[model samples]
Target: MRFLCILVVLFVGLKAFSQDSVSVPSIDTTQHTKDTLTIIGVGDIMMGTNFPEDKLPPNDGDFLLKDVESVLKSADVTFGNLEGTLLDSGGIPKKCNDPKVCYAFRTPARYVKNLINAGFDMMSLANNHAGDMGDEGRKSSMATLESAGIVHAGQMSQKTAIFEKEGIRYGLAAFAPNSNCVPLNDLQGAVQIVKELADTCDIVIVSFHGGAEGAQYQNVPRTNEIFHGENRGDVYKFSHTLIDAGADIIFGHGPHVTRAVEVYNNRFIAYSLGNFCTYRGISVNGVNGLAPIIKVFTDKQGNFFKAEITPTYQTYATGVRIDMQKQVIKKIQELTKKDFPESKTQIDDNGLITYLAQ
Candidate 1:
């Protein structure tokens, strides 16, 4: 009995020693790094001019974004310029004394779902046509977007839009040379607003609807552009100044054509993304129809690492479609090279954007 007792004690001690000696592997927390955020941006979008039923797109807007929905959805955030008001028909239209020189776009409020379905996270309501039906129209449009859970900025009263995604906060401010919107000409005011937003957010994006319009206005003039006796802000100075003031990305649209892409101090600037989708009252011929979906990749701090350009176009009466001809891509490449000859950014034939070797 004594021998059996001593043997049991020895066995228990050995089992306890074996369990205590077992080693567990250490976890590598660094290997689980977060992914870089992707932002996709486009130019003006007008689903259809709803004032007249004939101006609306075919199929009751069922096929408005059939082809490019996937492209827009692939990014973490998608944005565009809301070129018109979302209001019910019947509001007094802004007087366009000369139809040839002026145009107004009013989309039905019900169609706001289309923008939401297209995966647009935000929009810049700072363009000339946002007030097509005046203040009532603008307010209705804002309410519609709010109801649809879409963020918007550009109005002087609501100059900044703040949101968060994936633990990083984003600030968006829009400026344009128009009434009821943040004035693009007020560089100091714009800078102050951007700086304040930057101080609070992890990323800041500044959008401006400046420069001239139409196909002839494709080039970035680097000076103040004048259209119809109105002083459009100097886009080149505005972009650079905003970046210096703490904006990570600058998206410029007003010229209904794609312009150069520049990288200034690790920040990306798309001078003009061009007209993405327009139903009626707008022309979509030649370069005017070239719509580019600019995909931007940035670090947590909002420093641009690379970008991609997917060329798209709008057909008469139809919505946006991907352009296989690569005309828009080639045009932007040419413009970037011509406009910023010393730019370190490179746009390849495949629409891939990367920084050239130092």
Candidate 2:
């Protein structure tokens, strides 16, 4: 009897211990990982003077984007479309004022530091202004951006950049798809490169300077927005291709106007960020001037978590200060609502983007 009682007590104690062990939580640390990546992107950052009167030192142009410096730097990464070349050695292009010829953008080398100060993590030099002063100017822009430690993409050889943050590797590529923008012949090559990068990196971000200029019917959908036999780009199709090839985010610009944002294949594509900050451009400032900004959040594995757009309006003609007028904010809200009905654009009393959704 004594032996049987002792055996029962031991069995009971063992069972209780087993139950307690099972109740303990799993020790996996993935849930506690503090690695959340954020990328903030803006639109055409024109850094050139239209003429002698419109000319400002490269440093002067830097002030144009200074207003959003804090907001940009707050993100893990920030990027924009560098609208012009950064070479001061070249003369203006002869094609200026050809009706088809638009503007010449050549920033002085001295102002390169301002680009860094403005919180630009990356800049795309694949726009029309890239070769404004010709290939020499393009070369100079490349060297200048590199000297400032700014990652640049959209060139023939260095078409993509790889960045490692936390434990995640990010690959960024930019293309134009026609003319100086991307050269349609290189479309397949661009896609191949992005795919390869996607295989190695945790996330892939693609940028393109495409889409038709002005508010036209064709601009609503996707069309080959070529001008004077030159191919600028087709924003809609360009984005779709990149995403299909494993891109996590697609940033589009060069239309000088904000287009629609669509979620395709579980990815977010900003068709056109419009004009983020440009001084010397009047045609771009119609309606509510230019309001554009996109925010993205991702996890350690580079999976997108959430996104939102902060609409901003630059005052027309004045060229300084964001238009904080209530009517202007409401107008952007109405425009964005056309595509993202869940999106709401609200401005605070001081004229800042207080809240945004969808």
* TM of each candidate vs. truth: 0.89, 0.76
Q: Write the per-residue lDDT of candidate 1 for residues 205-278, one digit (tens) a residue.
A: 88899999888888898999998888988999999999999999888899888999999989999999988888
lDDT of 2 at 22: 11
Write one digit per residue (lDDT tens) for candidate 2, span 211-307.
6666552133556666656666556667778788888888888667776665666676777777776656435546425665667877755565666
Per-residue lDDT for 236 in model 1?
Answer: 96
What's the CA error at residue 194 for candidate 2, in Å? 1.1
Q: Note the Cα lDDT for every prediction shown.
A: 0.82, 0.62
Residue 52, candidate 1: alpha-carbon lDDT: 44
Candidate 2 lands at a TM-score of 0.76
Error of 2 at 298 (Å): 1.8
